[model samples]
Target: MHAPVPGHVPADRVFAFNIYGDPRLTEDVQASYQSLHRDAPEIFYSPLNGGHWMITRYEHIFDIVKDYEHFSVREMQIPRIENPPVFIPLSLDPPTNLPYRQALMPHFSPKAVSAMEPKLRAFAADFIDEVLARGECDFVHDIAARFPVSVFMELMGMPLDRLRDFRALADDYFKARTNEEIGALGERIIGLMTELVELRQKEPADDLISKMIEFQVDGRPIALGELQSMLFVMFLGGMDTVTNVASYTYRHLAQDDALQARLAADASLIPRFVEEGIRSFGVINTPRLVVKDCERFGVQFREGDMVLCVLPLGSRDDRRFENSAEFDIDRQALTHLTFSSGPHLCLGHNLARMEIRILTEEWIKRIPRFSLKPGLRHHSRVGTVIAIESLPIQWPV
Candidate 1:
């Protein structure tokens, strides 16, 4: 059926590294991507999730992602062509996608994020205060998971009352045991978004939803479906990414006391510490659909085939990075595909950074120092975003 797997990659080299489960991330899951890069050929076929070609090095991924004509980001799941309604802007490629990004640019800009700092800090403080009195906490649920979700709820003007319900459903969506289960949870979220959109239509307000409703593409308001899809993307992303990266970063810090102490001593390094954490632990290996039959990096692909641009591999490429495995916060000017490169670079990056930076600052200022609870292990899950599930941590009060 498919053009006999690309790159002449031996059936032996092809591996199913269980993007989400296997070799579950310890101190850092990006290590798994690095391990994949070091061990496999530049390109190999894996029958893991319905047999897709995996790119190991950064060079190829950079070129491929920028050139979307050959590779489409429309599909993420393998062996399964399931759709819970694709998110817009992200799903749209180039020229057309630019306008949608432009419309939202102002809301996510540095200036806008700076203005929101007070609210962001307050949210962080509220959560930290709840845990500060208690010497120990499950950093994953108590902080990492709720912070971003709550922020998104406030930002999008979603009902404040439903934040907890939405967050729980989202958590379940990622950790769902079966495809059907994830599908059901996804539908519930989408249904709620539909209701929110209807309410906003009759009575608009000062929020992302209203802002989006004002934008007209080619002199026409965005279709309800398109608008809902964009909102869905924002909701889905807002709930997950920061939670994942924050947990992973803290887990790394939890294990390394010296680094943790250094960060506490010099809060100025928090930004770089956050940057390096994102670089090494950016756990998503973004998937793209092969729209038409073509050859890439010495491999032939067919229409409908899938290619996974393992972002972690690109970010940790040894050829471009020295000591790629070692987590160095003060490393020379960092270059990475952690937020992705090219057209699809994460638009929410600014907000995501602000959240992580503030949280790191707050943690260092308050905790003095902390570590993973004894005899407990940290775990990570892979889906749209790679999140550390439960980071049990303890600090002397």
Candidate 2:
């Protein structure tokens, strides 16, 4: 069984607000780390999550993530996550990870994702068209969040209208403040996923969900619970990630007209902007358990110790980056740790990159400018996943 981290919290270190206790820990994470990384690059244990070792600097954190043999993904997930922790292949170490990833790899390849682009672009364009005439709307509800939800639903061959229904629970699941609440959200998504898997098993549509159901492992069909969990993870990862990326860009660009103009002037720069935006706002505060005792970065960890790596914080580490704190879109910072590093690097990364790049390009191409509406407050919460609750904005009709 996993136990709380054992180490002394440095006297100078101010404990970060537990990402689990409160959802607000995700927003402005850099500022939070800057407060801690000075005196302690690696906190012995954080008060958050019962004081797991918090990796604040880039070298130590990425090095651990890249070296999977020493730092395993098993039991990396919190027990409170919605789906049973079994679909946690992304959390799995190599050799074992290879087969599970292989089974689902076909769905996210460039060719497969590219085939869906026309449909995705059309969906994004239609979404833009709806909001373009309105002049003012919450970009989160109105655009940024909606596009990926619709795309994932379509990709899974699920009903498009059910987007709102799934999103309602998804938002709750991702923002679940308590372990009990997270479990309830998981039950809800699992119920929906069960229905989808059963239907797809019978119908076998030409979509990712059906393809996954047909995915054979060890000469037998993968079990329904496993398949459902995979679908749930896929839905959660795809929908939440792209939406957050778009929201990050819009929130930042809405206030920075000069930066917006620079991108608008050269649409080709949108990819770089998206990459940088991810570097700035990407939220994968995942943890890994040590397979055996190991030493790195002058710190030694014993077997079974949980090591938590904050991805975006590492991207800003001054040692690995030049002027790391500055948010220069053009700053070539070794391709940010946004998507993560090494073997278990996010599988949906290519599709996510394409979706954000195209959506940013299209949105800026049509709605060139926008501003955050006055008197409206935008709230960002950090949990297992970081998210923007609402983002209201106005642009020319």
The residue-level lDDT of candidate 2 at 132 comes to 84
Q: Write the per-residue lDDT of candidate 2 for residues 146-187, one digit (tens) a residue.
A: 898888888888888788878877777776655677667788
- Residue 135's lDDT within candidate 2 is 89
lDDT of 2: 0.74
- Residue 390 of model 2 has an lDDT of 89
Q: When superposed on Cα atoms, how far off is each prediction in RMSD?
A: 2.6, 3.1
Backbone clash pairs in model 1 (N, Cα, C under 3 Å; residues 3+ apart or in different chains), count: 0
Q: Estimate each model's TM-score.
A: 0.92, 0.90
Alpha carbon deviation, residue 197, candidate 1 (Å) = 1.6
